[model samples]
Target: MKKILALVLALALVLSCASALAAKVGVSMPTKDLQRWNQDGEYMEKLLTEAGFEAELQYASNDVPTQLNQVETMIDDGCEVIVIAAIEGSSLGAALDKAAEKGVKVIAYDRLLMDNANVDYYATFDNFKVGVVQGEFVEKALDLANAAGPFTFEFTAGDPGDNNAGFFFNGAMSVLKKYIDEGKIVVTSGQTEFADVATPTWKTDVAQKRAEDILTANYADGKKIDAWVCSNDSTALGVTNALEDNYDVDTLGWPIITGQDCDIANTKNMIAGKQSMSVFKDTRTLAAQVVKMVGQILAGETVDVNDEETYNNNVKVVPSFLCDPVFANAENYKTILIDSGYYTEDQLQ
Candidate 1:
């Protein structure tokens, strides 16, 4: 009996030592205010912990300086790897340089870290494809391919500081510019340039105000906006709010809006027919992929990357693993969101 007890205590000691020696990984999210970021951060932390790593998760509350400081703290805490979904792509150069000096591996998560030489790999959904899907949805809904009558359209892009915002805007523009040039689509607000239509921090209220101004100035003269191609769900929600509050439902009707992130509020909007479509990137899948990459990185194995050519972070092309995105509308939200166990019906309601 004493021998058995001694063996059990020895096993416990080994387990405790293993836990103490586990490699640490830091995950920095831009904000917890957004449901998507909350999901991403939680999922990643859970997965990393399950994989036997010390996961340090931090949310920067959408502040660049705060995010930088959080990352610095992670480095100082002896994190072997740091995964960052940057608040602003270009603002992390100093923090990332410190990470490099500490010989820590940095993975740009979802948001590409710009102008930094320390970013080792990028893991995100195909942002360009996200835009393409949005653009295609608008085209098919409006019958732009069949030369439908001239329609007034507007755009609402994400923060200019986000590298993915440019990719999203450009991808959508690639599909829509031909119609604009052919005179089939007109910019009602003349806010066609990305700079003009950008939402500063993907803030819903800011987007709402900008969208309100656009509707009041352009559509107030009895003109209708056929579509508003917003980059993500937050901006889409803003446009929806402005439309419902300002414009008469009978006169202007709801424009066919496009968005990404399949956020809960936007999913509710999609069900109510207030939102046309959203691109679902599935954070669970992304978190799993990132966790796998982290495991490989920790094991000193060659990390898997499918695309080595596309994402140039101004310093070098980041090795990227691009996940596919799917579009969700009212018709399939149940299947895509609920049935898939991403969300329960009660939660959405």
Candidate 2:
């Protein structure tokens, strides 16, 4: 009888220890307004929970102060790991300093947290490649290699505060700049600089307003925009909305617009022949990799990185694992998004 009691107590103690050791991980997202961030946060939470860890997910609604406060709260709540997709990459240095003081591990999720030594690892898709895919889509659709005349092109990039914005802009420009210089592509608005083309907050409404302004300034003379290389789906949606409202689609025809994130609305637009293509970064795959990385960190195993030199936060070079991104259009949305269970047909419809 004493032996049985002893065994019961021992089992209870083991269970308690296991519960205590289940480290809490905090995932901080920029905003829930964007479809991509919603998918990223939920996927990360689900994967972390399934991996025997506690997940604390927070959204900042595009506010930098709110994100910093949330990080402090997570730290107070005993989060051992903090994953942050910063609203502005450079705004989290002070908050991260506190996190580092507590010996908490930090992972920059999708968006690199810039100029902070507290960041331990970065997990993101190749942002430059995302732009390349967008540029290539335009090249193929316009038959730039074989076409005869010049095409009128415009650019729309993401928030200037976001570091990835530069990468996407540069990547697309790398492909299109030569054409622009050789007179194969022309920017009627003359808004070629990244600063001029940046859309604050990656807001669809801001992008729409900018598109309206661009159309008003450049196309009022009935000059048609042949292609619009928007950095992501939200911006693309804005451009599409502007064109649909301002231009006569029957005569002017829709431009070959590029986007990223494979957003459902944008995917549907692609299917309906409104938007041209979107760069699909599989958030599920990224979340799984991050979960695995967290597990390794907790287990005291070595974390792996494919990129050691590329991502510098102005303080130190962050070790990074860059996931590959692919472009999705009407032809392969079903195979890439639907068949892979990232979304269902009903969702896209």
Candidate 3:
């Protein structure tokens, strides 16, 4: 009877030991202003919880210092791993360094921090490829227009301070500059003509006013712009609004405008024949990969990222994973966003 009781007790102890091995993870997000980030965070939380790890999430509301403080707090809370979507790449250096010294694993989500090397893993879409697609889409759209003479245009880029923003702008401009040199597309006010081309924070009002001012000065000089290459959906929408407010979009022939992010309003606008196209980098796939990585880390299994690479200040050629980005126009609007459950028919309508 004592032997039987002892065996049962030993089994219970083993079960308790198994349960205690599961760890707590900390997730810090820069902001939830963008719909994708919010979705990504929720997906990560759900997956981590289901995998038997506790998740503590915090949002910085776009404040860099606040993100730093949150990381410090997560480290102090004895978190086994920290996932960061840093608000500003430069400001995150100090916090990441400190987290490394504590022997905590760090995963850089979406945007990689260039200044630090403490990150153990990174999962993000091919941001440079995203820009390339945006540029190529603009090129194709312009070819369809087949304008008669030189076409004047303007470019509205994202926050200049961010490295990803610069890559996006550079990639887009690389293709755009081809036409500009060939004199096929006339850039009246952009990196060449406009004095204020650097967008610091991606503020909507600032974008609107800049477009308004550009149209007032450049386009008003008897030069009708054939296209406007706004970087992302938000900026593209602002530029579209400014154009419509100032001049008749119908009369202007709705200058071929390009945008990214697959934003709800922008996707709807694409269906309604307003915007041209948007680059859709599915956040769901990205979230799933991140969850898988977290699970691997928890199980003491190695995650594979040899196919992906990025340069960090501390670690050159950091292992990373990048997914493909799709350019969604009117044709694939339903098939991509709706069919994939990213948006519903009612949502688009």
User: What would the per-residue lDDT of candidate 1 be over residues 121-200, giving only the tens digit for each residue?
Assistant: 99999999999999999999989999667988999999998999988999999999999999899998787889999999
The parts of candidate 2 lying over 4 Å away from their true place are: 1-21
User: Which pairs in model 2 have colliding backbones?
Assistant: 115-313
User: What ranges in model 1 sit over 4 Å off?
Assistant: 1-21
- Which segments of candidate 3 are over 4 A away from where they belong? 1-21, 144-149, 190-196, 306-309
State the displacement of the C-alpha of residue 112, model 2, in Å, after optimal TM-score superposition: 0.7
Give per-residue lDDT, candidate 2, residue 342.
Answer: 89
Report the C-alpha lDDT of model 3 over 1-349, residue by residue, as the tens digit.
9999999999998886566446778889878876666877888888778777888888899888898999899999988888888777667777778888988888888777766677778777787777788888877766734645576667888876565676677777777786787787777764553225655566567788888888887676446777777778878878878887875666667777788888987887888788889888887788778877776776678885744445454555567877788889899888988898888899877
Cα lDDT of model 2 by residue, 1-349, tens digit: 9999999999999986586458899999999999999999998998888888999999998999999999999999999999999999999888899999999999999889998889999999999988988888898888897897599999999999898999999999988998999899999989999999999999999999999998987788788789999999999999999999877777988989999999989999999999989999999999999999988887788997899999998999999999999989999999999999989989987
Question: Which candidate number would show the highest TM-score if scored against the true structure?
Answer: 2
Give the distance in Å from residue 128's predicted Cα in candidate 3 to where it truly belongs.
Answer: 1.2
User: Each prediction's Cα lDDT score?
Assistant: 0.92, 0.92, 0.77
- What range of 10 consecutive residues in model 1 has the weakest lDDT sum? 14-23
